[model samples]
Target: MKIRILRVFAAVLLLSFALPSVAQNVRYEQQGTAYVTAEDQWIADRLVDQAIGAPQGADAQVVFYRTHDQVPGPVRVDGGAGPLALLESGTCVALRLVPGSHAFVIDGRTVTVRVEPGERDYVRITSAPTGPKVAISNALTFLRLVTGKRDPLYASN
Candidate 1:
């Protein structure tokens, strides 16, 4: 009986560590864009109503790409009326924003983007000589390489 209890306790402890990793893997799919986690989806939905509220046709689209670098830390997004979402290198997140100007604070740097209806915008976060920087670009080629044949919004942690 004591051995059984010990085994159960061990299992519970092991699960506690494993559960966080599992939760991190849960991807929120929306309109061919994928949020890294359910919380990310919820926060984005709240900040930009069109993200998941509309069946189709977002007011605007924004893609954030975390460039591959030697940096070992995750970049976090702040401001823009949404909760923070941590981004790791080699991963990207696409956001649907309401038509307007929104500023996002990433890695302690501010990136302001103007969203126009029916427009697709892209931002890349890279390690710059000064530090981390966000730049606007046409990410079609990069997206194609990372997304492949899979749904444009599909992502896995």
Candidate 2:
């Protein structure tokens, strides 16, 4: 009886280890202009798997490519909104991520976005204020003003 029980346990362990290999793999596809926002933001994301919530491990990262040309410092993500991290680039931001919807706020500009597994979503953010003006402004003050603005894209959700 003891031998029989041990065999059953070993089989169960083997099956547990094997099952994950049968699980689905993430697939990516390049979306045409179909996914772009009304503001002309082009978004590229994965097609495989339902929306991932969060990934495990420290190596998982979300990279933000900011084509907007401004790298906001001391960036932060709203924890209540979703799981996301912020990385700085000269013009792009990289995020260490899981999968799911996220709100990316930089230089006080917020983009409410979603991510898929095994895919890099490239978006051209279009809500930026136009007409560049040269003026001396406090970085802290600017940060406060921009961050304080409740993101319309996020607030409605």
Give me the candidate number with maximum TM-score: 1
lDDT of 1 at 109: 85
Which candidate has the top score in lDDT? 1
lDDT of 1 by residue, 12-110 (tens): 999999997776554233322333444444443433334323323656877777877778778887765765567787777777778788899887789
lDDT of 2 by residue, 1-157 (tens): 9999999999999999977654421111133333222212211112111233223443333444322335344233334465344433223334445667766554355556565664344433322245222222222222223344432232111
The lDDT per prediction is: 0.65, 0.38
User: What's the count of clashing pairs in each model shown?
Assistant: 0, 9
TM-score of predicted model 1?
Answer: 0.52
Model 2: CA > 4 A from native? 1-61, 68-89, 125-157
Identify the runs in model 1 with alpha carbons over 4 angstroms from their true place.
Answer: 1-55, 128-130, 144-157
